[model samples]
Target chain A: MNHLASQLVLVPVILPLLGAGLCLAFGRSARAQRIISIVTLSIVVVAAGALLWRADQFGPQAVNVGGWPAELGISLVADRLSALLLVVSTVVTLSVLLYSFGQGIVEFGRDTPLSVFHPTFLVLSAGVSAAFLSADLFNLFVGFEILLAASYVLITLGGTEARVRAGTIYVIVSLISSVLFLISIAAVYAATGTVNLAALPERIAALPEPLQLVLQLMLLLTFSIKAAVFPLSAWLPDSYPTAPAPVTAVFAGLLTKVGIYAIIRVQTTVFPDQPLRTLLLCAAILTMVVGILGAVAQSDIKRLLSFTLVSHIGYMLFGIALATEAGYAGAIFYVVHHITVQTALFLVAGLIEYRTGTTQLDRLGGLARAAPVLAVLFFVPAMNLAGIPPFSGFLGKLALIQAGTESGDWLAYSGVGAGLAVSLLTLYAVAKAWNRAFWQPRDEHVDDDVPSTGALHPGQNTVTEDKVLRLPRGMALPTLALVAFSVALTVAAGPLIGVSQRAADELVERTPYIDAVLGDVP
Target chain B: MSVDLALIIAIGVLVACGTTLVLERSLTRILVGFVLLGNGVNLFFIVASGPPGAAPIVGASDERMADPLPQAMALTAIVITLGVTAFGLALAYRTWQLEGHDDVQDDVEDALVIRRAERDDTSASFDEVDESLPEEEGADLPAVDDEVTRENDEDHESPDDGDPR
Candidate 1:
C-alpha cells in the first residue's frame, strides 16, 4: 500500500505516455485511438484522486523511479501542492476529452486528423504530469519541452495559415524561454553544485549573493514566458484559439499552471530569499493589470478567455510571492479552482461555436433562450471566475486576499485589492459575453428560416443552425463533468482549503521539501 | 571557461539568424527564424552549464567533467523545437497552397471579416467587430472549412471547384 502511494504519483504521467504510444502505434484507426486515449485519461483521473487521498493522509512524499535513491535517480513527488494540481489536471483533461468525443473538430472540406490529436494530447498530458512530479530542474525542463512539443502539434493540427503563424510565434517564444531556463540551470549547478530541487536550498544558500540573483532572475524570465506573463504573453491569444476545442480547453486549464507551479517550486524551495519574492509581487500586479486590459479589449470569446487566463495567473502569483504558509495554501487552492473553472468556460465556448458557427460576440445572440443548459453550465464557471461568492473562484480569491493582508505587506495587499477589482472586471467581461451571445435580441434579416430550424433533441434547444445544432453527447458530457466538479469545489472549499492550508504550512516551513533534498535540514 | 566561449558564439549565431528571418516577408524564412531562435536558446542552455560537457548526473564520475543536466535540458529543448518546426513547415506549405504565395506581408489584410470591421466602420462595423476573423490560416483548419461550407450553403457551395489543386 505504501508502495502504491509512490505509483500514484506516476500514474498521470504514465497513463498519458501509454496512451500516446497506443495512439501512435495503432495510428490507422481513429476510433481505437480515441478509446485508448480516453481510457488512459480515466485511469489518470483515478490515480490523481487516489494521490490526493494519499497526500491528504501522509502529507508530502517523494518517489524515486526504479527504486533508485532520490539523489541518483529521477524522482516524482506529490506534496499537497502537486496533488492538488494533479486532481485539477485530471478533471480538466477528462472534460476536454469528453467534449471532443464523437465530434472531432469537423471542418467543411477536410476532416480533423484524429490520429494526430489523440497521441499529441496524450503526450501533452504526460508532459503536464511530468512537470508536476519532477523534483529536479533539468527534468522539469524535459517536462516543459514535452508539454510544448505536444502543444506545437495540437496548435498546428489544423495546418492552417493562421494556426501555423501563431504556432511559429509560440514555438519561438518557448524556444527562447527554454534556452534561458537551460542557462539558468547551468549557472545554478556551477554555483550551487546541484540541480536536485530538494538539495537546492543548501547549495543556493552557500552561493554568493549576486550570482544567486542572476540565476533566480533567469528562472523568473523563463517561467514568466511559460505562464504568459505580461510582456511575454504576446504569443498566447494568437495561437490558442486556432486549435480544436479540447486542445484549447486543456491549454487553458493545465498548460499555464505548469509554469506557475515551476515558479512556486523554484522560488520557495530553491531560492528562499527576499529579493525574488519582491520581484514576483511586482510581476503579479503587472500581469493582472495587463491581462484584464487585454480581456476588456477583446469581443471574441476565445481571445477574451485567453486574456482572462493571463489575469488569473496574477492571483496565483500573489500567493507565491507572499511566501507565507497561508499565502502558499491560498495559491494552491486557487490553482485547483481556476483550472476547473477555466476549462469549463472554454468548453462552453466551444459549444457556442458549435451552435452559431462562430465565436464572435456580434454574430451570437439570444442563446440563453436557446441553449439554456449550456447557459447554465457556462454561467456557473463564468460567475465563479468573476469571484462571486460561494464559487471556488471567490473562495480562492478571498483566501489569497486574507493571506496578503495578514502578511502585512502593503504592496501585496493593494495587489490583492487590484486582483479583486479585476475579478469584477473579469465578471464584467464574462457578463459582456453573456449579454452579447445569450441575451441580445436576434436579427430578423438573418433568420431566413434556414434548413436548420425545428424539433428539439433530448438535450438541445440551443440554436437554429444546420438542422438543429446537434452537438454530440461526448462534447457536452465532459464540459458538464468539469462544471459539476467546480461546483463540488465550491461546496467542499472548507475542507480543500484546510488541506491546502496544511500544505501551505509545509511549504512555508520548508523543512520537508528541503530535508528531502538537503538531507534532513539540520 | 572554454564552454562559456562556445556558448557565446553558438547563441550569437542563432540570434543573428533569428533576426534576419524576422525581417523576411516569406513565411518559410520566418519559420526558419523561429527554428534558429530556438536553437540559439538551446546554445544558451549549453553555455549556462559551464560549456556543454559538464555532466551533472549523479554518480557519473564525481569529477564532473561534463554536466548531464544541460545535456538533458537540451534534449528536451531540441525535441520541442522539432515539434514546433514541423508545425511551422506544415503551416507554411498550407499557406502557399491557399493564397499561392509564401510571403506573410501580402496576407496581412486578406481576411474579409476583419477588414470590413476595420474599414466599413458603420452599421456593419459592429457586425464586423462582432465576428472579427481573418481567413482561415492553414490547410487543416476546421473553422476555415466550416466557414467555407457555411458561406457555400448561403452563396456558392464550391468556389474552389476550379481550384489549382
Candidate 2:
C-alpha cells in the first residue's frame, strides 16, 4: 500500500466527484449535504497542495491508471504548471462554497436547489483537477466534458426566464465548441497513430506542415470559444450575469482559464512549429477591442464585469502569440493573477446585489455609504482588475507588454497598445459601474421594497438578507485571502515570474515531455 | 469522400433545420434547432474520422486496429452534447412555464431593465420617447443610461390585451 503513494495523486480528482454523488444520495438534509461537501472539498484542497509540493519534488510525474503502460492507457501527469492551476482552482471553488454558506443558494433548481448546488460544485472541482492533471488526450476530453456537464446544471439551476434564456445560448455555443474539438481530435488521430499528449511532438513532426497547421487551427477554434476570444465571445457577457452570484464568480474565475490553459498546452507541447503565432496576435487584438466595446455600453455591474472578462482574455492570448520565453511566462502569470482578482471582484458584485436588491447603477446607490466594509472589498479588486499599479493585475500586464515590446513585431506591438487601450477601457467601464452602484445616491424608497423596474425581466429572487451581508466573516475572510494573495503575487512578482519561465521553457523545449512519455525506457 | 453519403446528407438537412429553428420566435423551436445542430456536428465528425477505421476494440493485429482515440473523443463529445441539450431543453421548458411563452425576445420581463433596447422604426419614435420622458433627477452627473430600454417597456405595456402578459 505504501508503494502506491504516487497513485494518491488521482484522489483529489476522484474524492469530490464521489462526494457529489454522496450529496445527491443524501439529498434530504441541507445541513448534512453542506457538511459533506465542505469536508470533502477541504480534503481535496489539502490533497491539491500536497500534489503541488510533490510535483515540485518529482518534477512532472506521470501515473498510469490500472498500472497500464503510459502509451496504452490514461496517464495522470502532474507537472509544475498543472499543479499551479490545480491548486488555484480548488482554493477558489472551496472559497465560493464558504461564500455561498451565508449568501444561500439562490440560483437554479427549485426543489432542493442547495442539494443540487453542493453535489454539482464538488463534481466541478473534481473535473477541473482531472483536466489539469491529464496527460492523455482522451482523459483531457473526459475532463472537459465533466466540467461542461457540471456547468450546464449550474448555469440553468434557477430556471428563471433570464437564466434559462442565457443558458440556452451557453449550451448551444458550448455544444458547437465541443463538436469542433472532437473533429480536431479525430483528425489528429487519423494523421498520428496515438492520443497520448506525451508522444505528440515526434508524431506531429513526421506529419506534413499543412496537416500540422490544420490540427493546430482546429484546437485554436475550440479553445478560443472556451476562452471567449473576439468573434467567439458573444455568449459569455449575457450568460454569466443571469446565474447566481457565487456560481458566476466561480465560472469567471476558473472556466475560461481552462481554455487558455488548453491553448498554452497545445501550442507549446503539441505543435510548436505551427503558423499560429500571427493568427493568435490578430485574435488577441480583436478580442480586446470587441470585448471592451461591449463593456463600454453596459450599465449593469455584472454585465460590465463579464465583458471585462472577455477583454482580459485578449491580454493572456497576447502573451501566447509572442511565442517567446518571457511571453509564455507573462501569460501564465496573467492566468493566476486574473483568476484571483476576477473572482474577488465578482464576489464584491454579489455583495452589492445582496445589499441593494439590484446591480444596475441607476437603481443601486449609497453602497459606499450602505456597506463601507463591502465597499473597500469591492474597491481593491476593481482597481486590480483595471491593472492599477501595486496590484497583481498591473504586474501581469507589465510583464506581457514588456514581452511584446521586446519582440518588436509591428502587429505584436500594436497588440500591446491595444491591450493597454483595452485595460483603460476596462477601467472606465468598471469605474462607471462603481460610481453608479457605490458612489451615486440610490433610489432609497424603491430599494426599500423589491427595487422593481418591471420592464426588462421577470424578477429572479436575489436572497436579500436583513442581517447586513458585509462579507459574513467566513466568506469575506476567504475572499480577502484570495485578494491578499493577489497582492502577494505582485509583491513577489520576481519569483512568480521565475516559476512561469521554468514551466514555459520546458514546454517550448519539448524534449523532456517526449522522453518522459516515449521512454528513454529501454 | 467514401464516407457514408446518407449520414452526410442527413447532417446537412439537420444543419438547415437547426438554422431555421434557431431563427424562429419560439424558444422551444430554437432548442430543437440546437439539438439538431449538435447531432449534425456529430455526424460531420463521423464522416471526418473515416467511418471508424476499425472497431474501438484493441487487439492482436496492429495494422487492423481501428484508431480508438477519435472514437473516444467522439464518445466524450456526444455525452457533453447530451447533457447540454438536456439542460437547454429543461431551461426552455422552465421559461415556458414561468412566462407562458418561450420567445427569447421577451425572456426577461421585469428584471434586466438596463439591457432592454427598443429598435422602434426610426428616430421619429426615439425623439418622441426621449422628448416625452422626463430627465432623471441629477441631470448634471454623467449620463450612464441606466434608463429602461423602450422596447421592453413597450412589450410590457402591450397595446393589445390578448397577448400573454
Candidate 3:
C-alpha cells in the first residue's frame, strides 16, 4: 500500500509529455533535443520496469488522477499486462531514438534544424504509453489521436511525393478507423451509460444479447482495421515501407501491436464470455493464410517484411481466439517477442538500405561478404521471425500451438494448422530474401544509380577490399544493440513466459484489474 | 423524440454521403469525406444523449437535464476532427504541389498481389508484371532526385524559397 507505488502508473505517460514539451521549447537545437529525448526515454523505461515489478508484486495498481473518483474522472491503471507492454515499447522507442540520432547526424550536419523529429517522436511515445495505461475507453481514443497525429508527421518527414502519398493513405485509413471507434464508443456509452473500462463488464453483460453482439462486433471491426487483420490490412504494406527507416521500424513493430493489445484487453475484460470466438478464429485463419501468401509474393524486402508483420499478428489472434489461460499466455509472450524481433529486423533492413541504397531483393547481393555484421543482424531476427527452433519465436509458437491443441476445437486445430503453415512460409520468405540479398553474387546488371562497387564476389577472400559504403557507427551500433536484445529474449524465455502466464492469469481472472480500479466492488 | 429522430436522420445522410466521397480517388474529396464523417459521428453522439433537455448547469430546476457527457465528448471530437482536417489539407496541398495532382494513386502492387494470390498458380511467373514493367530508373532510390529537383525549383522561384511547404 505504498502511495508512490500505487501512483507509479502515471510516470510513463507524464515523463514523455514533459520531455516532448521540453524538446519543443528547445526548438532548432538538435543536440539539446537529442540529449533530452534520450535521457527522458531512459527514465521512462526505468519507471516502466519499476511499475511492472510493483504490479506483479501487488496484483495491479491504480491511481485516480486529480483525486476524482473512478468512473467519474480519468484513471491510470497498471496491471501486469499494461506494465509489461509499456516497458517493452519504451525500450524499443529508446533504441529507435538512438538509431534516429545516428540517422539524423548522417543526413544533416550535427548543427542542422531537424527539430521536428524529437518532439513528435516523444508525443508518439506518450500517446502509446497513455493508451496502455488508460483505464477508460474515451481516453484510449484520445491516445490513438495523439499517436496518429505524431505518426502522420513522422511518416511524411521529408514531404517528398512518395512519402506524402503514403502518409495520405495511412491517415485516411487511420482516420476512418478512429471514426468507427468513436461511433462504437458512443454506442457503448448509450447502452452502458459509462465509459470506464473497469465498470464495463457487468453493464455490458446486462445489455440484450443482440445489442451486445452488435456493440462487440463494432469494436472488433475497429480494432481489426487498426490491427491490420486480413481484408482490412491492404493499406499496411503499402503505407509502412515508404517511411524513413526508423519511422517504418517503429510503425511496423509497435503500432499494430497496440491494436492487438487492445483486442486482448477488451476481449478478455469487457466481453469475457467471448460470444464471437468462432468468428475470431475465422479471422485468425484468414489473416494468417492471406497475409503469408502476400508476403511470399513480394520481391521487395521491406514489403516482404511488412507482409510478414501482418501475418504474425494472426498468431496472437489465435491465442486470443482460444480464450484459455494458456492461450492468453502464449499471445502475451508472442507480443513481447514480436515487438523486439520485428523492430530489430526493420532496423537491420534500414542498415541494409543504408549500405545498398535499395531494399529490392533483385538489386542486393553479397552483403554477407561485404558486411558480415549486417548479415548476422538480419539472419538472426529473420530466423526468429520464421520461428526457428531454440529461439523465442519457436517457443512462443509452440506455446500457442499447445494452447490451441488444448482447446480441442476444430477451428482451433485449423488455426494451429494455419499457424504452422504461416511459420513455414515465413521461413521461406526470409530465406528467399537472405539467399538473394546475401548469398548470391552481386547483381552486376544493377542500374547506374547504385554507386557502390565495394560488394565483393561470393567466395572471394579479399576481405580487406576498400568498402565504399561506410556504415555510421551511430546507426550500426543501435542496430546491433537491438539484435542483442532479441537474442536476450531467446536466452530468457523461461522466466519471460512465466511472467506472461502470470499476466494471462490476471487477464483471464479479470478481478485483479477490476478491483484495482473499483476498489472491492462486488 | 422528434428532435432525436431528425438528428438520427441527419447522421444517416451525412454518413452515406461521407462514405461515397471517401471512396473517390481524389485526395481533396477524401478530406471532405473525413470531415463529413466526423460531423456525422458528432451528431450521432448528440442524438445518443436521448431527449435533449435544459443545459446541464446545476440549478434549482433541470430535472431532465441532458446527459452532457456525450456533448462534452462531441466537443472534444470536434476539436480533434478540426485538427486532423487541417493537417489533411496541408498534406493534400503538399501532394498537389509536388505531384501536380491530388489524386491518391491506388497501390499498383496490391492489386497484382491479390491477383496472384487468387490464381494460386506457379510462383515462377508470379511477379511477371513487375519484372516486365521495364524497371523505372532509380525507382527505389531515396530522396536524392526529389531534393535536387526541389532545390532547382527553389532557385527558380525566390518567393517560395523560404517556405518549407
Docking class for model 2 is incorrect
Better of 2 and 3 by lDDT: 3
lDDT of 3 by residue, A394-495 (tens): 999999999999999899999999999999999999998998889877744533222121232233222333344678889989888988988898899988
What tens digits encode model 3's per-residue C-alpha lDDT throughout B128-162?
A: 33222223366774444444445534265465554
Q: Rank the candidates by DockQ, best first.
A: 3, 2, 1
**lDDT of each residue in A146-258, candidate 1, tens digit only:** 89888877877667655665665665567667757766776676676567888777777787889888888888889989988777876777678767667788898988999
- Candidate 1 residue-wise lDDT, B12-91, digit = tens: 88878886886677878877787787777676666655643435656776574765655666677677667667766776
Chain B TM, every candidate: 0.57, 0.56, 0.64
Better of 1 and 3 by DockQ: 3
Write candidate 2's Cα lDDT for A219-334 as tens digits.
Answer: 88998999999899978987888788888999999999998988888787887864778888999999989888777766577877898999999999999999998888889989
**C-alpha RMSD between model 2 and the true structure:** 9.2
Q: Which candidate ranks first by DockQ, i.e. highest?
A: 3
Using TM-score as the measure, the top candidate is: 3
Error of 3 at A325 (Å): 0.5
Which 10-residue window in model 1 chain A sums to the lowest lDDT?
A: A448-457
lDDT of 2 by residue, B68-108 (tens): 55555666667766776777677777877877877765324
Fnat (0 to 1) per candidate:
0.22, 0.31, 0.49
Instruction: Give the local distance difference test score of model 2.
Output: 0.76
Relative to the true structure, candidate 2 reaches a TM of 0.84
